[model samples]
Target: MISTSPRATSVAGEPDAMSAREVLDLARSQQAAEDAAAARKLEAAARWADLHPPQSRHHAASFTLDGIEHEEAIAGDGCPTVAEFCIAELGTVLGISTTAAKRLIGHALELRHRLPRLWAAVHAGCVPAWRARLVAEATIHATPALTPASVAWIDAQVTPFAAKVGPAQLDRLVAEAIARQHPAEPVDPDDPHPACPDGRHVTIDADQVGFGGTTSVAAQLDLADALDLDHALQTGAAELKALGSTESLGARRAMALGHLARRQLALDLASATRLAADTDLAGQPTSLPAARALEFHLHFSAGLAGGLEIDHLGRMDEGQRLMVLDLVKSWCGDSHTKITVKPVIDLNTELTAPGYQPTGRQREQIALRDRTCVFPWCSQPARRCDLDHTVPFDHHAACDDPAQPGATTTSNLGALCRRHHRLKTHGRWQVSQPASGVFRWTSPHGHTYRRDSTGTTRVDSDPDPPAPPNRSSRAA
Candidate 1:
């Protein structure tokens, strides 16, 4: 009898008992099979596109499911009929976003029409699907304008190295192919380096702010200006290290950048400090006189005062926290700063009242607790978000009665960016807050996800309990 157990077969050295090399080969074969299967699925999606051609630049379709009618409109000169249909149908079938589905369809069309050689390699499982998609994307811009002969030539050049090259190397190869095909096209200049630009031109943008009080900054500058900024940051970081600062070099550099900007702007630190000191805890202007009318509040946890480690909503590390404290000290100068302790309100408690709007303190507390937009995978910081009520406020209107209004409390409120807020209000996406700061997000496709301070966790995975809030070493 053929032994079913691997150990028993291995001891007898049965023909089916493979060596390590043979097992590895079998695994590789299985992986290739899976890749080929995925390629076939993509091809099938592409074929569906061909079969269902859009009748007009603008089209409307309606379907009924479970006695409910659903209608969708597709309008835009640039949107192909095949693309619209595939994105809608395939997105539902695959349990993915329409954006993702559109990308898959785009890759499929690019492979089938633009790069036949790459498609062949993908279909044969010689090239992984991701790499195939990358090649298709890289070549797409050039392929549109090029002649069939030129596209074929570029395809031949790139196909042989598709499986062998990494993303960066493949990008280089694609650039070379484009250059060879379009010899007259102007090449982009190299990115800003340490050398200063000849002219003064600087543009700064805050690309994104995440849950942890972390901000991503994007900048474009003249070469000389870039170099000068880099040098200043390095110098300041070095100076900080010399002055008994234990922060990492990266943390010091970030602090240096902030300091350099402040110095350049000639911030009136003393005037600002005086204004802040005169302001009440509620941020109301006090009767005390101030050097300047403008005041700034540095919102931070009291734990940092006692030198305790706290990750700012997963945004800052110990080094960053230390640098922030040091920056605050520099701002304070020689003045004696008073630290006040306040009673901590239980977030889980319902603090709602008659009105729909939450109090300023409630807003601040909610923003601090839920660091980002409560939408799953959304990293927009709470400060930049809209405070949305999970349940519609009852205003004795047609839709709701005043007797049972949704309370304007922390448990009923969650932060959502304007776009997502509209989505929740209008789109089929349903959201509920079973507890304070914890949100359950249900997508249009019926997938449910839980979101909180840390990030998103799918409900199907038996997610762990929400992590306890990291408390400050010193009681507030």
Candidate 2:
């Protein structure tokens, strides 16, 4: 007999091998299982949100749901309030980042409370959870905010087509709903982000720097500004070619953007001089603007083909390592870059601090030692994370007191992303540091994880005593 259980892996219980038709049937069953799993994820997220009511007294966002007012700790046009650190833990458990988990939870809550018809379709399995979540997210984030009647109207419009709707169709439906809600301000269904002054934006995703030392750049600017930048890039690319740079136009344009960032182009334009000739770009124009100090995080081991992580640009492969060295040499040697020397930090050296705040040198050593957030599977750069004392700092205790704990020192410090740090502070989790750069974390649910210089690992899951009540997280 073929097991109908969702967890069953076999297509035929008695078979040595499945037939072709049975194999195809198994694929269909897997699809159904995936849909069921997606539904469960949403349900679990919604339940988690329900378990964590907003605790901050500082929020101004209040909305009514089921005749009860909810003071949202996050965006509060009309969503249920949730505890600040709740999303991060859920995100970590789900192998996603906090922001992504928050969006998933928000979509789930919006579907459950505001868009009942679509929500019903999802639970009935007529609409996939992904499709319904998309509709929910669109309605929840619509500008001018939808009235309850408008939302109900949207629910009715989408529920029938929920299974097949795409973002383009969803955008049109939301725009139509917006128009119906406000007769005075008609919305163009075709125009998503209207060409309003407020809509012009330049956004950077610093977290997305790839190992190839490149980042994704996006911008929507005024027509004149856009044209001006294009012209500047063209000029810079032309100048690079003139100076014998053989890189592609795209690469040259990238370098041009860097020049703009360093005020190199600005200074030249201000002087009203053409690109100077000094054999290469090194000889170009005026002296390079004062540059930020560069810190190279390099590792050396045998023919071991060690690793290197550059600031801002991220990791560069050794085969393409000239990409980093050449880029640095171009900036420093060609661009007349300024070099400031600082003593190298010995990662083995442990330092002490007399106060709760770690010294700058101490922070650098810790950053170098950990290199990334001290959380299981978390890759957030340590330099960007908060220096947390495993023993929470107590302002009441004297630093020199023999009995006092929570001293700020290298041995006591590890880096954690803000959400994880807030989770530790307010999510009723516990952490202990047995050695410098070695930490053990205990989740509220009792799973223990160890983080060290090598990486993070889950050591065990022993039942922990019940955790304390949730507390409000301090604002980042």
Candidate 3:
């Protein structure tokens, strides 16, 4: 027989004892009450600006909290503005750091001035304060030159949908709205200069030394220079792979980058010619020979070739694309190097492969389409990830599924980084590709996340929530 406590006996005898459902209902009721209280607190904080008035130099306010006396000083002309006073007062009252308090005050100011609808929603307890804050922050970041009219427009567009979507989706909607409003300037052919006045510079910093007398170096370089160096490292890494290096791709690439640097330094030292030919000789020894050939890839949509549209990465403008093409043509003409253009097609009808492994051509197309890992929040390049099937290949095969056969096609495959791949395989995360290059991910908690070429977003329920406004058009 199991021993029972007097409390258990009393609970068993009591008719008022709560059932599982009753307990859950009571807990939910408590949560709703707490949420309402929290919303009221946020509303009060947001209204602090209206409640407190700036004080003049001659008029000061002193307050005593706990045991310490604090004085509020003037911010301008020996007076404290409402914002400054709020920050100081809130920091002390909330027991938060001054920086955090200042941020809180800034958020309050933004809500009051820029996001009236969201503020109203939060005050009514219809929208969570955190979600409202997210919308406000996203709008502020996306539209740096925000005006009263623009803020009102953003509020109108976002307020209706903000309560229905998660933070990630709200962020994307705000970003898309901003992009539509402020399309990038058309690329100019004559503007071929670094964005920064200072040309690229590289500096190495000393990091911790490791075992075997190995030293670690940290360096920062400009984007273009860094990309060039990375490309060289990739080439070197490919060579190492051909020579049968046992190291992983990431490790090999690291070694290859260092090797390339050492090789360049050795070549520079061994040259017989003076560093400046004119300094050693009466005049320049001879015109320098043509520079070495350089090869790089550029991928863009056919429709974007003539239009002033941003590239897939959103980093290259139309003018930059034209500059790149012009430079490539000039280099090829001077060096007599052949240029090959290959088209990447998304095959929805063609089922050329039956096995679980994707064909080499299919892999290339998938890499080009994805550009980066398909996992949520992961920015790892597609080249470095494994192509994962949305459905378990073996499970499909075992079900005697001859109609589609779960063929290794583009629609069924996605590139996932190693970490995420394991998470999906063994963890509670589930993924499904409802359309080509579109992924829907379900978490253990039942929340869903969607990802496409643009970015990832967490949704409430809709599988294909009305596609966020078209980025190509204005006033979307």
Candidate 4:
């Protein structure tokens, strides 16, 4: 029966006569071989996870989901799948979230995408699991966030390893790592280490490459740790640059930095712009700027000399204009000291005319300049921005004669995207444009910085469109 069932395998006309003892020994040997294969696979898995530990605890915490871990924990007695165990280990040992852990294991399953040697090296404990997974991911997907040039560069580098995976996934993995390795703003060129007012130090660097084009990478860092990162990035960058592009070390390091840059931006863009929870105000819905709000201070020479106060106008129906007139009267006093007034808003970043009532052809110039967002870290096109008056046109102090006409002039108007507009108006921020296109902002405490418009040129290429369905982003 066994011979007829196809399980019995023997060369035709050979081994027809065999003892029961021999048959038992052969069966045992086959089982032993199978057990050995399982053991090797188990060892490979152990080697892999031990090396790649995932990213920072915060990243693991934020990106990872929890439900997956709960499921694995319940499957105690029965051994879980390789993926399940990997996810559980990251969560338990590294304290990473289950979602991120699952992502890591998922990358491991697609061996055809990554370099076999890199994979083996990871399993052999030579490379860190986070880095290994980075390599693994680069081998699989073509993430759209990466720029065409970077994608091309990655494509070239991974071609030799194409036997393992296609160009698309390889680019993705490289793009991911390059995105993660650096900060948003290049360390302040002066301090080499600068922090935001909220006490987070900026770590982004402009020179660093990403899946996308070059961008400033920013992050809060431990001063000492930041210094260490600065040295590593700077020094490694120098060495690879010196080695030239053809060298393996140079190419690998460059690709790695590209991955780090993109990942870091993705991380920062999320946290750096968290908004307040309140959405609806009275009957109308209000959306806070994605970033911090900007507040403007209209300083007057003296308290409104003869102006009406907001309290006095409580019964008036025309509150908006009355509010403007009241502010003008107070600041118009002849006292040498300037009187100040401020109007604030949560939704729009730029301080616009109270009722979208822009003065004169101010709107025409704003459209012409289409002045892109002036924030140092951002480059959103002007069509997406709101028109802001350098000097609030409504304030009397801002006018030549409050009675003659509202303050309106081309030079006084600037385009600030919603976020920077909010940041300037609400956050006690000040901007100074020493040159035509360049504008420098002074923080509330008087720290001065500038955003140069040097690299804001249009690109004219139809490279492979960014993946997914978005056509505009592809061209952009």
Q: How do all the candidates rank in terms of TM-score, highest first?
A: 2, 1, 3, 4
Q: What's the TM-score of each model vs. the native? A: 0.57, 0.72, 0.38, 0.24
Give the alpha-carbon lDDT of every model: 0.64, 0.69, 0.59, 0.43
Give the per-residue lDDT of model 2 (tens digit) for 188-258. 88998755436788887645544554667899898999999999999998888888889999999998888
The true-versus-predicted C-alpha distance at residue 172 of model 1, in Å, is: 0.4
The digit string of per-residue lDDT tens for model 1 on 1-476 reads 65566543644565565766887999999988888888997798677667656444344346323312222222111223462333444553565545566677777777777778988989887888888888766665553366656667777999999899898998899889877887654444774544432544454433432343345566667678789989999998988788778999998898778666545212334444556657778987654223222122233454546687543322232112223545444445522234344556445455664577788777767766776778776666677889998987776643334455466777889998875676677566777886678888766667777788777777745544454464332211
lDDT, candidate 4, 1-476, per-residue tens = 35764245567845556567888999988866654553344345445554544334453455654323222221111222342333433332333333454554455543322244544544454443445455545534433233434434443454344335544665565665445432255566678547644556666553233322223556777789879866666655665556563546554445446534434311223333444443466644353223322122222222345884334331111111122435434435312223334332121123234332564344533533333465544545555677776655554344345442334444446678765565566545676544333455554444444444332211123222222221110000
| Residue pairs in candidate 2 whose N, alpha carbon or C atoms collide under 3 angstroms | none
Highest-scoring model, lDDT: 2
Residues 357-377, candidate 3: write the lDDT tens digits: 788877776765666777665
Cα error, residue 87 of model 1, in Å, equals 7.4
Model 4, backbone clash pairs (residues 3+ apart or across chains), number: 68
Clashes of each: 6, 0, 5, 68
Query: RMSD (Cα, Å) of candidate 3?
Result: 26.4
Best candidate, TM-score:
2
Q: For candidate 1, what is the TM-score?
A: 0.57
Off by over 4 Å in 3: 1-20, 23-27, 51-86, 186-226, 232-248, 251-476
How many collisions between residues are there in candidate 3?
A: 5
